[model samples]
Each structure stands twice: as structure tokens, then as C-alpha cells.
Target: MNKRMTGVMAAGAAVITLCASSALAAAGRESSADMRGVSVLVGGGVEGYTRGLGADIQPGAAYGATVILRPTKVVGLELGYAGASNNFDRSNVAVSEATRGPDVMRNGGQAVATLGLTASPVQPYLLAGLGISRYNVRATAAGFQDDTVGNVPLGGGLRVHLGHFTADARINYNVLVDQQLATDLPSTSATSSTGGIYTGTVNLGSTF
Candidate 1:
């Protein structure tokens, strides 16, 4: 990763830690009715690529589920799983017009620490996490291999609570370390070991 991206991730982590500490301390003074204990959400959206991955891949569909555990009104922990399938750029790869290139599927899981900005029905939050992503190439080509990379996810979102149900819209920028995609394909030029994945999702679920 570049120095700028590394600095951003470090700053975000510091902010999340500070906010979490404040929220946990304030939780004891808040009323019990304001607490949200747990929730689960399932949804689908879209994901785009950046840096090295963007050179040979096209944006596509994404789906995922998330489980949130909140110990206080303003602090929570999120566990999430996401999968995406993107088509390869035919012009960049050595594939003919009659046959499209292989599908690039990415599956990942994350554990994030969240801090809500407010205690209202509509709340905005910040999150930072660590994750592992597996990139699989689904093609008939020989000598191809799959790769797994560690990632740092940093982003924020908005959550709206309606009675016992909640709706959330979020976006995350995943900074991938040691990611290698399309390296085995002929005529491919993306050689950078670091890349990024940009994801946007909306989820709906019940709160407990």
C-alpha cells in the first residue's frame, strides 16, 4: 500500500478506538431502553475495483450478510461476509469475442468495530476492520491459481431504526495487501501487488 492510504487507515483506526472508549464510558449513564443489543442483516448491491484489479476487471453484483452486536447505544461490533462476481475485460485478456473471459469471484469476511455518532433513530457511524479475501478464477484455462489476501476495511454508513426493524446503507474501501489478479493470463498488464475494492450495500433486518 502507498503511504497516503496507509496514513488514512491509521487515522481511521485511531478515531474508532477513541470513539469506542467514549461510548462505552457513556453507556452506563444512558437509559436501558436506548440500547440495541443485536441485529442481523442480509442484502445485495454492487462492487467496483480500483488500482491493479481495475485494469482487467469490470464492476459487478455483490451480496452479503452482517451480524451486529451492540453493548451500548453508541458502540457495536460487526461480523460480515460478502461475495462478488466480476467479469474480465476481454480487450485486456487474451479471450476471443465469441467467448468472454473468466469470471473473477471474490469472497471475504470481516470483523469491524463500529461507533455510532448519535443516539437517535437515524444514526451515522464509522467503522474499521480486518478481513481476508479469496480470489478465485473460474475458467477452463490451465495452470491458473487462486489467491488469498489480507485486507483493511475502512468506511462509514447510516442506520435507520423503525420499531423492531432497521435499515442500513454503507460503503467500504478495502485495501488489499499482496493481491495478485490476472497474472496468469496472456496480454495482461496489471502488475501491482496492492489493490482496492469499493463496495456499497443496503441491508434490512430485525433488531433484538
Candidate 2:
């Protein structure tokens, strides 16, 4: 695995560790409020790489896990890890080209503030989060380093609770954050990648 993939895995592992630690900490609490409990969910789904990396990447396999801490009936804290693998190939041979581009992956982590709409078995919630993404790119292309960019995820989802099990469907629109001009593939001067990542996935989980 390359550094990009390593970084992605590291970030994801870190999030999982944090979640475990938080759950342990919460386990010692004496709160009787179910709304103030800790919950962990594991699931996998497909993601659409609608506009990632200059806009054109196609949909790919996406899967992730998340941990939630609800402090109140209407508010919660969530940390998640999402990863998608795609066949990444782009070229601008007229000026420059990414000759070794293919099968590049995208990995990301998110920290969001979740607001629940109701306390019923069927609930809807909105989530807004800040996330960082690492792209696994081909290194043969000079001056083309794998990008680690920040992004904002804005979306909401619906959740159905039955007993201790839950099912969820969410769609998030990723707005790739802007950055200063960094590099030029053909060593002309500099350029920036302005695009976005969008995803829609379903998850199945249970509360403990």
C-alpha cells in the first residue's frame, strides 16, 4: 500500500479507536436517559464519486462504520469512517497527462453534529460535518502528488428503529474545500482542483 492508502487507513483506524474509547467512557456513566447513551453501527453501501478530483469520477463501492453519542433528544455527536474504491484515470496529454492513473481509491473520515427531528421509532436527522479526504493517485506522474483535501458534508437521513436494531439511509453532498494554487502537472506554474464528492448509502445497525 502507498502512503495515500496508509494515511487513509490510519485516519479511519484512529476514528474507530476514538469511538471505542468514548463508548468505554460512557459505559461508566450512571445516566438513565436512553437519549444520552452511546451507539455504534457497522454497515456498507455504494457511493457516487460524482465530482471528485476535477469532476468526472464515477460511482464506486463505499462502506463505513460510525459511532454516535446522543447528549439530548435532539442532538448527538457522530464520528465516522468512509472509504470508496474507484478506477481513477484522467489525462490532459495535450498539456499533461496522468499516464499511471487507474484504480485510485478515496478514503475519508468525518466528525459531525447530528440533530434529530423526533424521538419516535422512525426518526429523521440532519448532519453537517467537516471531513478530510486522501486520494490514492499514481506517483509516476511528476509533480502530481496524492491530494489530501478538506471538505464539508451537508445532508440528512432517515432512521427506523425496531427493538435494538436500526436501518438508515443517508445522502451527503460533499463540497470540496478550496485551497491555494499548489502544483502544475507539466511544470507550467500552478493549478487547483475544484470539485465535490457526493454519496448515498444505506446502513444496518443495532444499539446496545
Candidate 3:
């Protein structure tokens, strides 16, 4: 009889131990699964960019957000928006046979879509995206006037996650698709342009 009682107690202890182990493993799995989901973030910041023929545009304010659909631990799709203004600087001068002079400034907004690859929870990533931009140029002699433009930008950047939010810095070499000539300027004046838009951007966002 004593032998039978000892055996029963041993069996009960074994079952309890197995149940505890199972519970711990289940909790660990849930924690890992939480890493994969839809995250929405918004941020406002700045960028330095250029827009038409030669390299000459200044920095301006920019703001935007990214919505990420993370399917796995390392892959996702990010839909983002960014807007920046271009202010002209005389230091951006070109030497030409026509003339050497100051020109107009340009600024605008961009809507973008990117596919990204992440390496960690607080990850640094790379993205290839397309941007739809509306550019406006303002000359000091005249008020602010603008031209609409479209571009395809292939780029990459880094992101840092701090609990509820993330901060990012990115650079894009935007190739303008539509080419518009500014021949209306006085024929004797130097025909310098803003150039293909190249941008360096930084923004902050929070996840919900």
C-alpha cells in the first residue's frame, strides 16, 4: 500500500511540472508574435533637396509618416509621405557664357511608397520607393509661382525605435520624369536650373 501511494504522488508531481513548462513556452511564443503586426507612425521634420537642371537648391522643412505592414520578422511594406520647401541661395552660382546671376527658388511635397527590409526590433533599413511631387519656384523679383513635377526616387535609410516612437534619416536621388524648360527668362540671362531633385531627409514618428 505504501508503494502505491508513493507512485501516485510522483505521477502528480510530474504532471504539474509539465504544465508549468508548457505555460512558460506559450508565453514566450506570444511575446515573439507581438513583433509582427501593422504599425502606423507619424512625424514632422526637414529635408535638403534640389529640382531641375544643375545642382543648386537649399534646405527646407519636411514632414511625414510611415505605415508598415510587417509580414515576417524582417520584411515589410511602408507607405510614406514627405513634404519640403526649396529656398534659393546666391552662393549656388554657375559660370556661363550667357551670364552669372541669381535665380528662383523651388519647394514642394512628395507622396511615397517603399518596400523595406528590417534586421532587428530597433532596425536600420533600406527602401526603394516612388514619389509624386509638386514643385513651386519663387523668384525675388516675382512672388511665389510653381510648376507641377513627378519623380522616381530610389533610396535607403535608417530608423531607430524608442518604445512608442521611431526616428529616421534618409537620402534619395530623385530623377525627375518630366522635363520643363525655363526659356521665358530674358535670353541674355544664364539658364541655370534647380537640377534633378536629390534629398536628405529626417523625421520622427510614433506608433499606435
Candidate 4:
């Protein structure tokens, strides 16, 4: 395991610990105008990016859930899980030239805090959070084992609420961990990755 992964896991544990304590205290209170009491979010979206020798990178669909604990009417803490896989087509490569480039899969968790502007028909909101992503890349080239990478995402999104359900769109930029990409491959060297780590997602969920 890489040290970056260890740090990510540690941060996730800390978020869980803090949210657990908050959830317990919030549970004793009744749902009111100022608080949601409890909510569960379920949604899916696309992810796109590439590294090394892939020109056409396929977008991957991801599904995840977020459990929310509302301490105040407008403030909430959420923990979420998301995962996806991507495959890219490679051309004009010396070593893996005969074969397609690689297929990659990533899984990770996020911790966020949401501030609801208004909990009404049009509930626009803002979210800020820290995310940890673990990615495994496998190339078709022989002697190239799967590469595991980790990254942190920082960004926000907008949400609109309707009754028990809500729709939202968010954009986040991923900062890949340095050590993960510093390693080299046989045919190619991991210099820098192309495409923006920026990801856009649309989601829907219900409050319980």
C-alpha cells in the first residue's frame, strides 16, 4: 500500500468518526423546518480522463450513495461512495502498438458538507468536500502489471429540491497523488496526464 492511500483511509476514518457522533445527537431530535433529520442520496454520472498513450478515452458511468446527517436546518454533513471504470484506445505506440492501450478502474469515498440556501420547491445549495479516489490501471502490454493510483478531489455543486427528491449537478477537479504516477512503465514513461481532471455529475436522491 502506498502512503497516499494510507492518508486517504485515515481521513475517511476521521470523517466517519465525526459524522457518527453528530448523527447520534441529531437522532434524538424530531424532523423540523430547519433540519432534514435523515437523508439518503443515490445517483450516477460519467467520468473521463487519461494518462500516457491513450488518445480516445472512454467515459465511465458511476453510481454511489450519500448518507446525510443534519445538525442544523440548513447545514448537513454527508459521506458518499463512488466507483467507475474507463478504457482507452491507443495508436502509434512502440511497445503496446500492436495492442490497445489500457483499461482502468477506480473506487473511492468522499466527505462533504452541504449548505441549503432554501429547503423549498427550489432548494439551491452549495457543497464543499474532500474526496479520495483509488484507481487501478491495466495495460494490454505484457510485463505491465496493474497500476494502483490515488487522488483527492476538491469542488462544489448545485442542487434543487422537490418534495422528498432532489436533482443536482456538480463539477470537481482531481489532484492525483504524485507518487502514484511517478512510477514508470516499459513502453511509456508517466510524464504527465492529458485532459482535465474536471468531472461533471448529475444526481437525484430522497430524504428519509
Candidate 5:
């Protein structure tokens, strides 16, 4: 893990701990029905890289799992892990055969706070969080260096609750910081050091 990733993970841990403590304290004053329990979700979707990363990586399939802890009907915290497989765009004829590389695997972890607009069966929510992303590519003759970066994810989604089951459609726009991919291409400037990722997913889960 890079320094930025390590810092994000530490900050996330602190925020989660504080939120959990606050939730426990509030639970004592709230009715059982008003406190939503924990939920686990599994989902898959597509992700597109933008800016620097988009120049070399192709959009691809993404999958993830999430754990949500709702202390109150309208407030919750989410821990999520997601991964995507993206192919290198080799259309650039200037690229030498030796510089060409295999598929790239992108993985990320996030800790987010969510706020629901309403407590009805159908709820719309906003989320913002801190996250870390890692981009791994198999070493090539050109000696590409893998990178890890910290990110901020911001987005919103709608959730439908049916008895103990829930379904959600969510999208997140991730801003990546200090992302340096050391491809060391011959003619072109090395890959961009900053980029963005657009992700959307549909998740189904059960509340306990």
C-alpha cells in the first residue's frame, strides 16, 4: 500500500469507529423499528476510466460487495470493495510491440457515509467517501510500474425495500489523486498521473 492509501485507510477506520460509537449511543434512545440493522449486498456493473487512464485502458465489467450499517432510518455507513478488469487499448500504432501489455486489474476499497432523503419504502440517498484504488498490470518488457492512489467517491442512488430484502441502483464518480503509471513509453508522455472513474451498479441484499 502506498502512503496515500495507508492514510485513507487510517482515516476511514477512525470515521467508522466514531460512527459506530455514535450509533450505539443513539440506539439507546431510539425505538427498535427506527434503527435499521446491517445489510450485505453483492453486485456487478461496468466502469469507465477517464482522463489519463482512459487514454490507455478500455472500459470493462466490475463487481463488488458491500456491507451497510444503518444506525438510524436515514443515516448509514457503508464499507465496499470492488474490482474491474480492463484491457489495454493497443490501437495506438506508435506503441512498440515490447511496450504492449496485458489486461489491467483495478481494485478499490471505500468507506462511505450515506443519508437517505426519506424513510419510505422507496428511498433516495446521497453518499460521499474516502477510498483507495490499485491498478495492477503484468510486467512487460517495457517495465510498467503498478500504482496505488487515494480517491474520493461521490454519488447518489435509489433503494427499494421489500420486507427484509432491498435493491439498489447506485453510481459513483471517483476522483483519483496522485496516480502515476510509469509506463515509460518511447514517444508518448508517460500515462497521466490523474484521472477519474465512473462506476454504476445494481445491488440486491438482505437486512438483518
Candidate 6:
């Protein structure tokens, strides 16, 4: 499933890029082929696990770097890596099984499509992407053995550009798509919940 999703995402990204470039060419915006730029972003944010897991996971800080390729002023492709550590929320869930709930090491890479609302310096954009997240959960009691799955991230935000400086803020929800993650969990168990993540971040970057 991960392999198939990756291929579909790559194909989809290509189609979107082609259509965007063609539209820009028809609009006479500096020939999409000739107009190209790159940006490097540094960002930090908070995220949390949501779903039916053995234990409640607390929201935690996350940070990552992203490189953007802008083929046109209004269209860009982004590739990034981010990771966060979440501890089980012991206050709400039962922790008697061991000492703590499952400890998870979440990390992944994402390919995204960004569409700017305008070509101006201060532009608002919408973005959505596909990612494969490795959810390393240590829960011997709940029967969750597998560790990785696909994600659907939906988000939008504003980008402020000033000379070589760029800044942006965004919020997103990452939905996990695989049901087999709970292959070991009993069907009646609450730990068999489908998990997701929510994040909000601000970034500072430089464009060249």
C-alpha cells in the first residue's frame, strides 16, 4: 500500500505541476520554464496524536526543514522532513500495565503541492500532501505490532515575502489511512482506534 500510494502521489504531483505551469504560460507570467527559484525554510510547531490508542498521547513540539522549488510565482513543490516525540498521557489512561503507555518515535518525509492565491509578495496559499509516517509504538499489552503507514495532510496558510526573506504560518491535520495498524489488537478493544495528528507551525526562510 505504501509503495502504491507513493507512486500515485508522485504522479499526482507531476500532473499538478504540469497544469500549473501551463496555466501560468497562458497567463503570460514570465514563461514557467524560465522562471524558477528556490527557498529553504526553518520551522517549528506543535502536534498531537488523536485516535483510539491504548493510551492518550500528549501534544509535543516538532521542527523541520523544507526546500521549495518554485517553477512560477504562484506554484511550488515542497519536500520536507519532520519528527516529534509523544509520551503517553498517563493522567487520563490507565498506566498500570507497565510504567508508561506506549512510547512512539514519529518521523517522516512529505511531498507537497503549493498554490499561491496571487503573485504578490504577501501571498496566501493552500497545500495538501501525502506522507509515510513511521509510528514506532511500544505497546506490548495492546497487541499493536506494525509500525508504519500513509498520511493525508490537508492545510493552508499565508506567506510573507520581503526581498530575500520569507515567512509563513500554517495549520494541518494528518489523517492516518491504514486500518491494518491494529492487526494485533482485539476487535472490541478501544486501543484499536484509527489515529491521526494535528499540527500548527510558523516558518522563516530565504528565497534565491
**Candidate of highest TM-score:** 1
C-alpha lDDT values of all predictions: 0.69, 0.60, 0.48, 0.54, 0.68, 0.65
Deviation of model 3 at 146, angstroms? 2.1
The pairs that clash in candidate 6 are: none
lDDT pick, better of 2 and 3: 2
Q: RMSD per prediction, one decimal?
A: 8.9, 10.4, 19.6, 11.7, 11.3, 10.9
Compared with the true structure, what per-residue lDDT tens digits does model 1 show for residues 1-208? 3343344445444543444444445544334233487999887667777765676667777789999998877898989998988776666654433335437788989899989999865578999999998888775333334788777889998776655666677778887765645454332223324357887766778789
Per-model TM values vs. the true structure: 0.74, 0.66, 0.57, 0.61, 0.72, 0.69
User: In candidate 5, which residue ranges exceed 4 Å CA deviation?
Assistant: 1-35, 93-102, 139-144, 182-193
How do all the candidates rank in terms of lDDT, highest first? 1, 5, 6, 2, 4, 3
Please identify which of the two predictions, 2 or 6, would achieve the higher lDDT against the true structure: 6
lDDT of 3 by residue, 102-201 (tens): 2333343444544446444344456655556555444432222355556666676655444444455566676665434233322212222444554555
Q: Report the C-alpha lDDT of model 2 over 67-186, residue by residue, as the tens digit.
A: 888776677788999887654334531214444334556788999988888765456789998888887754343334567767788998766555455556677777766532124422
Instruction: Write model 4 residue lDDT over 1-208, tens digit each, in one string.
Output: 2243334335434543443344435533234222466677676665655454224445555567778887755687989887776665434222353434336666788888878776443344577676666666554533233444445566665554434554556656655544242234223222235323545555666666
lDDT of 1: 0.69
Candidate 3 collision pairs? 51-195, 52-194, 52-195, 53-195
Candidate No. with top lDDT: 1
For candidate 6, the per-residue lDDT at 79 reads 97
In candidate 3, which residue ranges exceed 4 Å CA deviation? 1-35, 44-46, 50-55, 91-118, 140-145, 162-164, 181-194
Which scores greater on TM-score, model 2 or model 6? 6
Kindly provide the TM-score of model 6 when superposed on the true structure, using C-alpha atoms. Answer: 0.69
Candidate 3 RMSD computed on C-alpha atoms after optimal superposition onto the true structure: 19.6
